[model samples]
Target: MAGVESAFPTKRLSVPTADPQPSFLVFGAPRIEEAEIAEVEACLRSGWLGTGPRVAQFEQDFARWRGVTPSRVAAVNSCTAALHVSMVAANLEPESEVITTPLTFCATVNAILHAGLTPVLADVDPHTQNIDPAAIEAAITPRTRAILPVHFAGRPCDMDRIMAIANKHGLVVVEDCAHAIESEFRGRPVGTFGDFGCFSFYVTKNVVTGEGGMILGRHEESIARARILALHGMSKDAWHRFSDQGYRHYQVVECGFKYNMMDLQAAIGIHQLARVEANWQRRRQLWERYDQDLAGLPLQLPPPPEPDTRHGYHLYTVMIDETRCGIGRDGFLEAMNTARIGTGVHYLSVPEHPYYQQRFGWRPDQWPHAVRLGRQTVSLPLSPAMSHADLARVIEAVHGLIPA
Candidate 1:
């Protein structure tokens, strides 16, 4: 597979080398094309780098891709902003608890705090690495206002069970879809199952917009309010206020944050969104190859995608337990870096971080599975931009690291 040409056009950053030291492979490198470059250049030339037509176009494109109406989505600066705004728009009571998985990015928890709500941790399933529905049910209290379920690593959480739990408890559902743009569960997209679905377009994400996100809402009014809240709570956005027709007066409906997505970022995202399917296919190939090559290594590979579910294949993670692999997780990271290959730790469970511990009196022991998985998890490179030679280099480096 090393020398085989890929079905998609190669976006190689470097050629295979005999040099003991070569260019360090950056994890999560985005696959950028000439179309994106041209669109960005055009956007710069238009003198409308702020939130404008490009942002509007990107939002429409994304909404269509997600099988929703244009009015159902609102673009923002980051997934963090999306989460924060969604929670605010949902009208969750201040300081009311929002249940979420421990095995997710801090932004998920922090958004609840930003929205003036308490974030309660629910332990994840050891096998699925997603928030267990039972844990969510067990964590719910009279004050629990919402459920924030992250589609961790692009695997859709058991949405049917989760929705059932949310429905039973009458809790609002705000899906953290930062890793699940292309994920679907049981023939339906992941984000649609919740009241509000938040997605990311960070530089390393499946869609590269430098820094951008979008919110999908079940109700038009909620999405419209989110749009207003995203841009300083103004009744009229900049695009409408200063369009070619004429300047229009606007009113500030409520105090809000500056979370609007810029046209410059949207320019890159428009083309990226167009190529999403092709890129997803490329990533699927790489994921399958990784499974094949990494087999028999003393590591715990991610389980197969679940039935009736479409995984986003965002990260190819493996748990390197020292007792079996003869190398600690941190040591494996160091070895990979020494070999000029890059890797990532998807996360260190929320409670493991000191800020959460000090603020909430939480401990890793409370969520043992998340803590253990966090300690051993390593995200190997998985990007459409990677060449077969690059794949071979990573595999060779990993094979060389483990003891016989």
Candidate 2:
């Protein structure tokens, strides 16, 4: 497929003389409703606000949504926690290397370090901003035990190629689906393709939990292990120990982290999951609007979903052409802020971060595509909560900044 920059010709848009938007448009706001609020209030009143019935129900609901068995999912506090637990479940040896894309959140790499594993950076595909399978193949080494592919901006990664490479190398696959709750590739969900699929339900995610995540997998034993590891390695969960069966003593089977999700967050998630499809549809409409409105400017819009796939439309990111636009990505961001519109940088590649550069001795030149993307990419406001007026304001602000 052609890269995003060459996918469309830049069209010239007329500049507007109107004053900037009067109010600040916050990016990625959760579409909270009375149902969410009432559920949370009920959870608080029940006083079983910890990981109880609500969390369990949320996990089951999530599993059902993903077409997976309930036992294959483990709910946690954050995607980072889910990733860490996944690493443990995979049983990666200390110092084992995991090949992953540089175009991802720090947490994606941090989880590897936390698991006592080395993270080997692979560059991303220019078009999708997702880890390229060829880059992953080249990064593989004798010590490489896994491949962590991130579904960038809710677009499914090329999982078929990734699975083939993993199978050839006998490597585990842990999918980072933080932006892909509703994403599917070739009729299957993104998370189910890997040994472990880590999902985020952060406030900005397609599904809002305020703060939560879930791990999905096919291995019953791995999922069981993750459940134990997510809650301080207890053999029996709180609910199991204090349920109708009276106080049953629990055992500390192994060293684990406190990463369990609470009912308060899960209360929001329960309703959020129920409305996820509806919310995704709304986001798709907004994404289409942005694509239509922002065309012809000196910017490269996000590529369309791959064939036979469903996009979650979690984020609508664009790449600015500094030379053509007369402003760099940072400059564009500042202009948007001045115009009372909120914007975000999905990420600067992992190698660009000082810690990774110094610790791993990585250079930006090592990953040309990721470096270019890191320099130019910008995430525009995209959410089901955004109104048509909000969309218009964003379009007007962006067009006003770039010359026709």
The lDDT leader among the candidates is 1
- Alpha-carbon TM-score of each model against the true structure: 0.95, 0.94
Q: What lDDT, from 0 to 1, does candidate 1 have?
A: 0.94
What lDDT does model 2 reach? 0.92
Q: What are the clashing pairs of model 2?
A: 11-296
Where does the lowest 10-residue lDDT sum fall in candidate 2?
12-21
Off by over 4 Å in 1: 1-20
- In the range 132-170, model 1's lDDT, one tens digit per residue, is 999998998899989999998989999999999989889
For candidate 2, write residues 1-404 as lDDT tens digits. 65987777899688878865488888899999999999999988988888889999998998888888999999999999999999998998999999999999999999999999999998999998999999998888899999999999999999999999999999999999999989999999999999999999998999989899999987999999999999999998888888777998999998999999999999999999999889999999999999898887878889889899998898898988888888899988988988888899988988999999999899999999999998898999999999999998888888888866
**Model-by-model lDDT, in order?**
0.94, 0.92
